[model samples]
Target: MLVNIELENAEDFVFIKQLLEKIKGVKSVCVKEEEEFYEDGTPKWFIDKLADYADSLEEKDMISKKDFFKFIDEEICRLNSQK
Candidate 1:
């Protein structure tokens, strides 16, 4: 789910502190940050496969383990505030 978290000052800039409340009640979350996951040199097979999977998820399930790991790592640090 996409949530617009507005920040006013340096205090509000600490929105990461609210991550616990944010994730209080949720299921699987697929976070695709444009600033992080965007690129140009993508393979045609990858593009076609993702598009095909998007169309028929139940028929042929396909997901990116590489991106999934990256997202999980990010969420872990984001929650822990280790960065």
Candidate 2:
């Protein structure tokens, strides 16, 4: 049987994997790290939506990539602070 476990800390993976491997019926254990959508931790879906919104904008309303990233960073910081 394949079981998926989510760990709170990456450091705990090796310890957990070892423990699972000792179980009698276990076959093999595989480790897969969590996938990252973007380097800045932005979700791919959100980026796609942003791209669609930008595409719909008029030429004069479009913003530079640097400014766009600055806005995204600020938004992320603001959202994280609220939590």
Best TM-score goes to which candidate? 2
lDDT of 1 by residue, 1-83 (tens): 65654444546544654553577665433433333233686766677779987887662455588978999999998989965
Candidate 2 per-residue C-alpha lDDT over 1-83 given as tens digits, one digit per residue, 9 for 90 to 100: 67899888889989998999899999989877675589888978788999999889998997999999999999999999999
Provide the lowest-lDDT 10-residue window in model 2. 31-40
* Model 2 residue 1 CA deviation in Å: 1.9
**lDDT values for all models:** 0.61, 0.89
Q: TM-score for all predictions?
A: 0.26, 0.41
Evaluate model 1: give its TM-score: 0.26
User: Candidate 1: where are CA atoms >4 Å away?
Assistant: 1-62
